[model samples]
Target: MSIRILTAALFLAIMGLLVAQRFSLPPELTVRVAASLGEDAGYGFGEGLRRGSVVETGDGFLQLTIGVELENLDQAKTILWLAPNTRIELERLYEDEMTIRFTRGRIIASNETDVPLKIKTNYTSHLVLDDVASFVNYDFLETIHVIPLSGSVQVNAGSSESLLTPVPLAIHETDPVTFEKLEVNLEAGDAAEFYRWAGVLTGL
Candidate 1:
């Protein structure tokens, strides 16, 4: 009888440890303050975020001057490289899909996940999985621009959803907010495109 009791106790202990580990793991959607050149390094918006933290669905960010790097560690292998003056939110986080709503500005998305990775803007929808791309949502007079870097980004404009596009393959080097980033001579743009790049600081 004592042996049976000991076995049951061991089983319960193991189950309790598993439950605690699952709960203690980092939130699936985690936020890391993007690197910035200036002292005011982080901006907060939507639902009184006030500071960067794990985001659940419906957490909106606006005019994020300091930029925020988001990673979906559990549900997806993805990261969003945000530019300043960007507006976005964690729109949906589900088992089969993950989506980020881009209201304005730009993003450099790196998505390598099995789940469908989608970005929705006001006018279009994009599938950016299995690739890295840059997406612009028409700042100022410019229209939505898509520039794929390594792999292809599937775009759907004027439909019910929106996807993002890439900038000049060389755009990553001129990170407007970062004072010191690993210099990726990853792009070369024209004079006009370079001019537009200046407005990235304020998300114009």
Candidate 2:
């Protein structure tokens, strides 16, 4: 009967949708706030966040009052640690690329997948290499201070581009350094280790 055929078609469509979702990249990232991160920190991750919250891409900006860890789903396999007082937005997400807009603050990024992670700041955009640990810091005035621990990052601003090794790239916001090689006294991995946070954290 015509009714039976229509029901079968509807069932087939549902199954097809399910199959597609099963193979696609997960649309959300798990947010974990440490117990020490005070209650104010919860207000920053405000996309209907709860314990073990999973925030989807483009949910809105996350302005943290304390440091928190964002872990991608098992399929994506990436982790981002957002430092305190940091504000960032999940810019875009795709099967082959993931991007984050750095409004301010620091992010310790570890990308495990081959999908290139792109970080966009006010002055420049950086392509984080796969399997590399990167320490990205964007302050209110300093703007940029990226330290690649192992691999290099493709720093781009408009048509300019450069693949920079583990070197200090600290510059004032007015003087944005895009393609040029910035040399600082600190070697690679030293900044990430010795760079001090502004204040001490004490839990009650």
Candidate 3:
């Protein structure tokens, strides 16, 4: 009888240990560039702007958010990462270099300029960015609607938006942005076509 009791206790202890380890395990999130608005904006998956952390996950998706900026507005560039349920806000404008990255639960941004910058997010609706200068990157996010809160912001395709060559803009929708694939690149001159393709891919 004593032997059976000892065996039972050992089993319980092993089960407890297994449960603890499972709970302690960290979540997994991937970072990808979501969007950009300026003419001179630059982004890449390698080098100084390629770090990410896990934030949250549900239904085979993770969420993240980040904020970054350029230092000189005359030199340097920026990059970004994307994750599930990510939100970011831009606090400064016209920087020389700026980068934002998001992955799983981790979000990272680097600013070389002397001025201050910030990025905020709304996770309740998956991902919602309040500012256009602020960018987002994620594979799960299909459609991004730029709704102007005050004046108006341009959604540049390749780099910068000019008075003669206007940036493509889209109205916000009640449905979530969906995407078949997520790609990150510098704005060139095809803002309208790219956004139109994204809309079709995301079913928005």
- Tens-digit lDDT track of model 1 for 39-60: 2224432222222232221222
Tens digits of per-residue lDDT, candidate 3, 1-204, equal 999999999999999999998786443222343343232123322112222322232212211122332332223222232222443332223332222222222232323334322332232122112222323333344334332222233333222322211132232221442222223332344333333322322321
Q: What would the C-alpha RMSD of candidate 1 be, to one decimal place?
A: 13.5
Instruction: Please provide TM-scores, in order, for all candidate models, with all chains considered together.
Output: 0.48, 0.54, 0.22
Name the candidate, 1 or 3, with the larger lDDT value: 1
Question: Residue 132 of candidate 2: its Cα lDDT?
Answer: 43
Work out candidate 3's RMSD over C-alphas: 17.1
lDDT of each model, Cα atoms only? 0.49, 0.51, 0.31
Candidate 2 has a TM-score of: 0.54
What digit string (tens of lDDT, one per residue) describes model 2 on residues 1-66?
Answer: 999999999999999999998788554443443212332344443223332233222212222211
Q: Which candidate is the best by lDDT?
A: 2
